[model samples]
Target chain A: MNENRNNLKLGIFITLGTICFVAALYLLGAKQNLFGGTFEIKAIFNNVNGLQKGNNVRYSGINVGTVKEIVILNDTAIEVNMMVQIDVHEFIKVDAIASLGNDGLMGNKLVNISPGGSRSRTIEVGETLLSINELDADEMLRRLEETNKNISLITSSLVGIVDKIDKGEGPIGTLLNDNNMALDLAKTMTNIRELSFQTASLSQNLSKSFNNFQSSENTIGMLMNDTVLAAEIRTVVDELKNFGTNSEKISSDLNTIVSGIKKGEGTVGTLLSDSIANDDIIKSIDNLQKGSEAFNENMQALKQNFLFRRYFKKLEKKK
Target chain B: MIQTKGQFQSAKRFLFLVGDIGQFTLRFFREGFHKPFEWKEILKQCGEVGYRSLSLVGVTAFIMGLVLTIQSRPTLVEFGAESWLPAMVSVSLIREIGPVITALICAGKIGSRIGAELGSMRVTEQIDAMEVSGTNPFKYLVTTRVLATSLMLPLLVIFADTIALYGSFLAVNIKGAVSFQLFFNQVFETLEFSDLIPSILKSFFFGFIIGIIGCYMGYNSKKGTEGVGKSANSAVVVASLMVFILDLIAVQITDLFYEL
Candidate 1:
């Protein structure tokens, strides 16, 4: 019994120790997501950026999987297999983009999946997702180099512009450098000041003359200042207004008469509007012009004749 | 001439001692397999070596953990990585400190006990008497004790590591609070199989060295009562030194295989 008790005690101690060790192992395995409803997926990358097996796979900043394997497919590409939890599969889509990310600035490399659109098909077991390579340090450095070149170009151009300005070459430089232009501007400003001063004095004199006119000392002033003269001017303005109204009525009558003539409503209207009458008038004017021309021709013939020439010369001497 | 003769005698003695230990190691391997397997003796030894030494190992490991945490706190806090306390302490304890410290403690406690017990038995002619009584003394004594130490050390180290991590957890909470789950998560996250297996494997070597050294010293002890004391003392000293040496070799081997 004593031996059995000691053995039992020893056995229990050993068992407990072994349990602790195994528990540690189990916990570690669990942390690595070893025992789970896991599904495998593949992502191919031109470069994995030092991503290793057992690195975390995060979705929306939460760890949902682990990198299971990394196989170099060729000189240019590598295939990374990941074991993700099955429950998170609903969140992952076929169009999800996998990219390499770091845990922290100097921490381990992990794969981060950008959640795909809701309308896209969900990712299934063993399906491949598109991988996007992060901008590596070298790529960033290369871009920085280009930016530096551009900055240098801009800076050099700026320096050249500054140099031109310093040399008084451009419009800005001329504005700064032209002493004669500055003096001319100053003289023009002084002339404008004097003109304004003279205009002010002339306005003051005009106001004095207007005041004198308003004192009832001059005829024009009396005409402006006297109440009776003001009444007469108002009466004249009223009569003018009446005459303007009468003239407007006469213009309206004339417009009516013209419109009646256009429509051939009266005798004069018929005469003006009738096309035959207009033809007769044009014929009469033409006959009159012909008679005048005939008369001039006869006079010229008579002057050429000896008898009429002497008679015309005596008439001219009597006039 | 006298000094030369003394030097030559010592050199011969050293070579004979080496030869004797080599032969003893071989005989242990040979007889260990041919056993009416000493399960009972092994159990008793497990109790003696592993259970009895727990307090000493545990206290030392706890102190080591606490001290390591306290010492490493300032540096890690300076780096703003105070949160890494559990992981760092766990790695150091599991990979190196826990195993080596426990093994050394066992060397001092168990090694000395085995050497003295066997030495006293030898000095008192009990081993010879047991042999005369038609029992295989080597199997019953050296094999059981050696196997027991070898088997028990790893388990002890596991216990030590657990206890030390607890101490570290306490120390971590002294300055700041960290949940047990988070602490353990950090620990397991930082630890790899490479860190664990190599350290546990090396403890077995340490155990074997301690057991074999103790057994050898005790078996080859001379000059009666004075020799028993000397055997115990020399066993502890040699075993402790061998623990460090074996640890160095184990680290190198592990690095070569795992790191490369």
Candidate 2:
């Protein structure tokens, strides 16, 4: 009986140990989503970024599956196969995007899946999903270096512009810094003030002159205001009109006489117009000239002769 | 000159001892398979080595877990990762600490017990009597005890691990509140099949080394009653040393298979 009891205790101890082992296995397996209806899907990536088999696959921040296999297809690409729960496969659509991500800032690498749009159909088993490779540390460092260079360039240019402004080198700088221009502006303002004062005085004088004209204090004002003087000036203008009418009549008579003379109806017209009379006049003028010359010669002879010389001298002396 | 002569005699005896132990292990393998299978002896051993040692193993495991948690708390708290206490304790205990500590305890407890018991039997000529009575003494004695220790150590380690986690759970609640479900969830979440399988497998090796060392020492004891005490003492020393060596090799082998 003691032997049997000992065997029974031994059996119970073994059974309990076995149960604990099985429980541990079940817990670990369930955590990896092993004991479930699952579907397989593949994704191809340029790089897995150190993702390993048994890494979690998450959708919408919830773990849905685990990476089952990773195969390097070529030098540039890799194929990752994931075993996902069947219930979550509905949330993963045909056009869903898969990418590598970290569990936390410094945690394990995992595959993150973004649910597809409403237009996409639900993903089927064995379908290949799209994958995006995460940026490697080297690529991120390179980008950071470029950004640092750009920031330094911008800061240097800004510093140069600030230095130039401080030295008063541009239009804005001259406006801020040139003392001569400010003085010139002040002088011009003073000149404008003087000119405005003179112009005000001139306008005041013109107003005074206008007031005098309105009060009939000047000739122009009296000429404008005296009605009798205006009427006398009108009579004088009437008399000048009568005189102009008489002069016009006399000018007409003179025009008639000039027309008759031009028609050769008078003595002066006959002398001017008759060619025979013109020759007779010319002969008479020539006879007169000859006679005058002969008379002048006789007179000269008389003055030079002894008998007439004395009488001509006495007449000259008396004159 | 006398001391030098004595050193040289001791060295020669040590080499002879090595050869004798090797021969005994080889003979165990030879007789182990040709056995009139000793199921009754193996079962009785299991009761003694596994069930009877549970309280001692349990107390040691609880202290290890409690002390590990209490000690590790300040450091993790400094990093603001106090919540990770369960996972950290679970992984450490399951993967390395629990198995090794339990095996060392067994090496001291069961290994020495087996060594002394067998040494007494050998000195009393009980083993020779069995041999003359037309029975295989090695097959009946060494094979059953070795098999029992090998099988029972792993089960004891599993029990030790469970109790250790419970102790850690208690320690965790001393300063903070955590639900049993959440703490266990965190523990299992951190534990992987690789951590568990390799550790349990190494415990088997630890058990085998303990059994073989104990049986070899006792089965080949000399000098009568004085030899019995020496066998028991050397059995523990060699078994405990062999446990560490095997643990190192096991870690290397596990790393080669899993890490690479």
Candidate 3:
């Protein structure tokens, strides 16, 4: 019984030890993806930061694989080999880009593989994954310095503009500070307004005077407004009408005489119809024009022969 | 007169302690490697130390795992890390609780037995007879008992650790929900070779301390049966204290190496 018991106890210890070993193996194997198919891709980076060989490889936030190896290519560049799940092979493409990213702000760093576009060709086994290096610390600091300088300049310019406004030193200042200019403008506006008012009053007065003269209310108003001028005009018109009637009779007699002359039956008509009579009238008119011209010239010659000057001198002495 | 008296008393106690400790250690080393290997005796001791103590260790480990899980829940929840229960429990078991609880149980069970048995033999003149017969009394007595404890305690710790994890599983399902397989997965996933190796290593130290202290106390016992009882009680006390001390040193050493 004791011997059997001893055997049984030994058997138990061995079995427990085996169980522990198997359990540890299973855990390690699962982590290494031993039972699953996987594909490999490699990428080259200028820096790996803190990325390690066993660090996770996340594709679109899902942990699809882990880093297999990391090698320093040069002083400045590193090459990372990753084994991705075979099932996700279709999602990876030749143009797929990889970037080193941290798990969180303070968490471990990992490699992040961006899903390539559908249009891109599927990546083949052992193909090198494209890598994009993040901005180096020095470059980032340089850009930050440039940005800060620009901000400082813009702020200083803004301060200068604000100072100018505060000092009231430009067109805006004049508008704000010059009260006399405002007063002058106000005075000019008042003068124009008064002149317009006076002009309006004067027009009103003129209209009143015209109305007084047109209305038959007083003597002058009556003379201007009543029809007395019309009566005088009518009397003149009656006299003109009588004159026109007498003229008409005289014109008829003249027409008869002219016709008799044409027929050579009256004295005036004979004179008009006779050629000798016409020539005598023309000769007389010519003689009269010549006599007038000669008299005017003799007067002028007599005045200029000192007689006009002597008379003017005698008249001046007497005055 | 007073100073002389105190000095004399101290000297006597010191001599007695030395004689007992020396004899126990010497016999332990001797019989441990002697011919005839004491396989039967070892088996009987193994049953006594390991199998008989199973229920007590199991019950304690189960409650320990359950209580630890329950207590840890609110704290982990505060950090929003409730899912870390399995990993956290496994680490605690492998590093701290597994070795500690196992050692405590052994101190209570095995340490007292070794001390009392040896002390009894010393008082009863069994040790004197074996010495007279040239059988090497300390060798037969101290060696086998110490060897049994040293070997058995580690095994017990291993069994205790396994049971503790199971207890943690049951505890996990009490107020929370985690499948057994999944719990074990999470536990093993976070547990590395470092955790396993260090914990297993520390349990051996615990066993050694228990064995040495128990055999040392019992072999040096005096004052007949009363001395035997006193030694047994003191052995349990000292061994338990040693367990904590050794655990502390183990942790420090583990940390020093592990941090690198």
DockQ of each: 0.60, 0.63, 0.11
Interface RMSD for model 1 amounts to 1.1
| Range of the 10 consecutive residues with the lowest summed lDDT in candidate 2 chain A | A169-178
Q: Which candidate leads in TM-score?
A: 1
Residue pairs with backbone atoms closer than 3 Å in model 1 (clashes): none
TM-score, cand. 1 vs. native: 0.72
lDDT of each: 0.90, 0.90, 0.81
Across all candidates, what is each one's fraction of true contacts kept? 0.68, 0.94, 0.06
Ranking the candidates on TM-score from highest down gives: 1, 2, 3
lDDT of 3 at A208: 93
Per model, how many backbone clashes are there? Answer: 0, 0, 1
lDDT of 2 by residue, A240-268 (tens): 99989989999999898889889997998
Choose 2 or 3, whichever is better by lDDT. 2
Question: Which is the leading candidate under DockQ?
Answer: 2
